[model samples]
Target: MSAIAIDQPTYEVGARKWLITITVITCAIMELIDTSIVNVATRQIAGNLGATVEETAWVITAYAISNIIIIPLTGFLGDIFGRKNYFTASVLLFTIASFMCGFSGSIWMLIAWRFVQGIGGGALLATAQTVLVETFPPDELNKANGIFGAGIVMGPTLGPVLGGYLTDNYSWHWIFYVNIPIGIAAAILSWKYIKGTKTEMKGKIDYWGILALVVGIGSLQMVLEEGERKDWFSSLFIVIFSILAIGGICLFILRELKAKNPVVDLRVLRFRNVAVGSALRFAFGLSIYCSIFLYPVFVQGFLGWNATRTGLLILPSAFLTGMLMGVNGALIKKGISPKALLIFGFAMVIAYEYITYMLATPAAGEWDFFWPQLVRGLGFGFIFVPAASLTLAGLKGKDIGQASGLSNMLQLLGGSVGLALINTYVARRIVAHRVDLMGNLSIYNPESNERLQMLTTQLIEQGNSSQQAQQMAMSIMERSLSTQSSIIAYGEGFMMIGVICAVILPLVFMARIKKGEALDVGSAH
Candidate 1:
């Protein structure tokens, strides 16, 4: 690769830095919060809209697919229009969509509004990261990443908590309604405070790349989101979408590589560290998103804990994650080997998963989960900023924007793909576990006979009827089998995720990553 000019522009830093930071972080967090905030409120939304549970799920899927489609193209969009103009417009689009989402009359209407919302929200994330990086000096990029990473990790974690609260106290619409004020403020702030300096490109739009990504990513996202729901390939919808996803992606890759001006710069992956960083990013997405998806639902749904209680249980770990991000940032700035931080992060995450597998029993309580969750927060804090710093370190200024866009998109896509796989794995595990448990409970087994007799007799003593008691005994035994199977399935998930993490750990060392040490070490030392 030929050396390119690093045309980094600059401005004075003071209140401007603080203002831009708050503005972008708020916008980024708002976009992220929307990703998960509506998850818990799906049931209420279904009932209110007179839609089935299956149909209401489209509300979530619509936002996610659109978000994924737009994320990678954001860099090109910013190049076409100025970043500030594009950023401000996206915020306004998001704010308006939030209002429309709240007032939506039907489930389809809500889904449509949410799709628009996702398009806007997607730009906010990729652009916000670029803006954050530009706002700080090169040496302090890790610190900026630290602050941004805190929001990235915290947003999804807090989403369910906020959604549960809004749905419980107010109504489901309030979840969407809540975004309007925040979005409006973020939009105005982005317009006024966030400066733009990129030169606009003079060329035709990459329409082919855009269409290919939209179809490819959109279909892939759909297949991931709806595959299990539609019984994978058994449903014609899954088969068609799977084909489109594969074909579209292949076309997108070809189109981008050959295009004079690609919508996405896939060539950025050619950088040694970018490839390794992307892998780590994928792992981070898979583990973090899966943990958020499963743990709370397992606690609240299976253990009979309420939503608020579950949210509180997970909060301490998230808080620690946020604080440690700042610490890790400072460490990276002080010449800490990000490889060491990354390895530590991988180990901590695996340990957390192991603890989770061991403790995911029928009897686990809030306290039992406390330590494991805290460890997870530490793992994430260690992983995010360092990996991000490693990824973009070698890129020229021109490549950095597209590189950031692609990396962020991959991470989100990884989470979606991971969630689908986990759901399938857990479902299959439940069935396998149930089959194994049933083998021991067969009528021919001596212990099984004794237990069944004891249950029937005990029920007869209370109910005064042999026939009724026998039926009740059978029903109770079946319930126990289902419950035990579910617990075992959940427990197995931790190990599965841990093994995946272990598999990816060696890649960190293999990458020829440059250390964060440099001349402008500053006060961080």
Candidate 2:
């Protein structure tokens, strides 16, 4: 526990402060790292469980869906149950689910456990951010957020890297089993170090709002996760979930407006900074997640790099971003404008994405990514902390808790939507580009004729019969053409993300708060 005395000027500065900080950051990191860790091991999981690849993908979607549904509800649940007890229980739940995930007998069992794991993981994220915010005074808020931001940045990058190593050297189960020690430590630290007031539970639970929230958000997540697999509205499940999403959301709005106490509190968004902040967060999530998803797929699928190499390539970039967080904090503390930092951050994103766009080539190598990735890290350092702080700048008490939940939920939702769009776009664009490339392979095109003839001759020289050699040459040509088409499709994805970042650049001006003045929600306890 911390050593803050009664005579101390502020609870924000003490040994206990750092203890609580580490506890929350560790839990958040474990949650985040788990999010991407299973991705690289999907095939292994499918084979081990005797399931198809598509069935295994549900493991990913189930966790993601549960995360989105649970994030916004964390604050309300914490208020009802006591924040410290709730947080500690969530850690224990997450740890237990992780163990269950490792020992699952079938795909469905794994998916169910993964969903349960996400419920705990989701609460840890939002609650951790809220707890970290409460630990800092108003004047030093950005620096605290900066520390949190580093954990956020490292999680996704580390997930694939660490998962790759564990799966390659050991087995898929180690990825889940590895969480036991970290989870137990985090649970103990949270119980002892996290300090907060016990809620009064003054009014009746908003049962209607709670049901509506579950139906609305849950259905919406299903639509997003399974849309590509189910072909959007063409499938019956998508249609039903879409309708439920729409109807539930409408009922939820009406119910919250009339209720004396709301479960999620949509009313807090009436605050201007919160409104603007949510929009910015959506854009940030879209750009960041889409880029992260695209790069690994493109490099490993097209460039022929192994999963381990791909993860290693991304490590330096994430490290630079984590390192720059302190400098960003120091700058924010000195009264430099956060809006100015935001503008620069947006510029860096544009630069990173556009550079990535230009870097797309069949001949590009690992060294080509080093500088662009470093810039990417630096850009995020300037972005997430200020964006979060400015959003909750003027609010106090439960508003901060509610806003934090909303903020975290929006960002995760943004990642889901961004991933969905990227998948659709890449699928469509690949076909379009392939057709356009094939158009030039006509008999009249001398270059195409010459290349095919050269390949046929080489095959014949290697002792193949003439007819079989020509057929093989043509097959090889088709594959080469497809690979080029895929590269162009991925390049287009990067450019689309760049456009999203640019579109949000204008929102930087609308923010109402500045540096060093971010967190003023006094003594949430």
Candidate 3:
């Protein structure tokens, strides 16, 4: 165990601070990169591991489940151990897990290692943000946040590109191997420059809270990750886990409320800003994740694009988002109200979603996505910084950490929920659209009969018998109709998400806290 001390005087922006910041940010990028990096390689991994595509999806689901469960508790763990020690250990653990993940021969083994990787990866994300915030003084905090925000946006965007390139050129294992050198560099810098500020606590470990939390969050994540694939409540396993998840979460909330030293301080909801901010953050998470989730699927599934092409197409939008984050951060520092920025952000996102819905079609190409994706980047830029600054504006010391944890947890949960919901709706819409389109099918339908006859003639010209040509033409016609139906479903899905974002706009008025008020909650204990 590492020794603890009281919060020290604010550090100067010297070589030490800069070095530590780089280390923490690098680790953060590593963690975020893994979240989507493996997505492009999923097919390869499934083939190599002798697992079906559906079963191999556990590699992603397992990591996500562990990440959501561990993120809320990072603050408490950092407090229990020294921050530097905890962070260093997490990096080491994450690095080792990455290696194990790359080396696993079986799908289950890979999933287990990925879960362990998530335990370490979760700490890196929140802890890095807290560390960066603490390193800068109040005056320069927005600038610090902008830097951090860039990494947050960049990581996911770059993940697919890098993973796709590596998987196509070399092997999928290189995705994990690439983290090794970066991890080593971060660990060395952290050891040299990262300092610990400790707090005092006296109580038994909240084992019950931890148990309830893990059980609740883990079950909830499992349901979200697999719910669509399992046909929602139609599957017995999904139904059972859904019940456990809901029950466990309710019990966890009650336990946290009553516990003197709660694992997560549910009491922080008393602050109107924090509470409202968390809700917005959840919505933001939903929008961001769903958009990201949909983009790749649309491109690959509908357009027949390769992974590399799909990944590269997203890069410009992400860079634009990074640039916008900096601009928005500067605006916040200049005394602009966060509410205005947040409202504008939501409007921009809604517009972007509408654009996406309009542009979604079987014939849509990479160029068609560029403008809307750039708009998305700008919208996210407006949302992330101001929302976070406003939420924690009045919070001080430990509450900052707690608020951070809560906000991040909600974001994760929101992403999971949004993705699951969108996928479910997409599936339903496909069936409905298919039926609707099929209802009009008849020999008397002039356009349909002409199309079928044309296709039949082409098949017959290619040496098929008359009857076989007719059957082939019908099959092709059905496939074309199904494809159109899927495109329509995807469009509707995007539109629904836009409506959801629009609905969240009213809550911005409920936030009463002014900017610059110091929040009183201390660091996680």
Candidate 1's residue-wise lDDT over 1-525, tens digit each?
Answer: 112222445733999898889998888888999999999999999999999989999999999999999998787777667678999999999999999999999999999999999999998888888888777877678778888998899889889999999999999999888989888888888888876655635566789989999999999999999988888999999999999999999999999998877878788888888889989999999988998988987898789998799999889989898898888889877878788999999899999999999999889988899999999988988999878877876666567776778789989988998899999999999999999998877789998789999999999989659999988988899898899899889888877888888999999986665564342211110
Q: Count clashes in each candidate, considering only residues at least 3 apart in sequence or on different chains.
A: 0, 2, 11
Ranked candidates, highest lDDT first: 1, 3, 2
Per-residue lDDT of model 3, residues 382-472, tens digit only: 8888778778887776777788889988977888899999999999999999999996566989999998899999999999999999999
Q: TM-score, each model? A: 0.95, 0.95, 0.96
Q: With candidate 2 superimposed using the best TM-score fit, by how many Å does residue 301's alpha carbon deviate from the native? A: 0.7
Model 2, span 434-480: residue lDDT tens: 99999767669999889999999999999999999999999999999
- What C-alpha lDDT, on a 0 to 100 scale, does residue 348 get in candidate 1? 95
Return the top candidate by lDDT.
Answer: 1
Error of 1 at 187 (Å): 1.2
The lDDT for every candidate, in the order shown, is 0.86, 0.84, 0.85
Q: Cα-based RMSD of the predictions, in order?
A: 3.2, 3.3, 2.0
Predict model 1's lDDT versus the native: 0.86
Mark the regions of model 2 whose C-alpha exceeds 4 Å error after superposition: 1-12, 514-518, 523-525
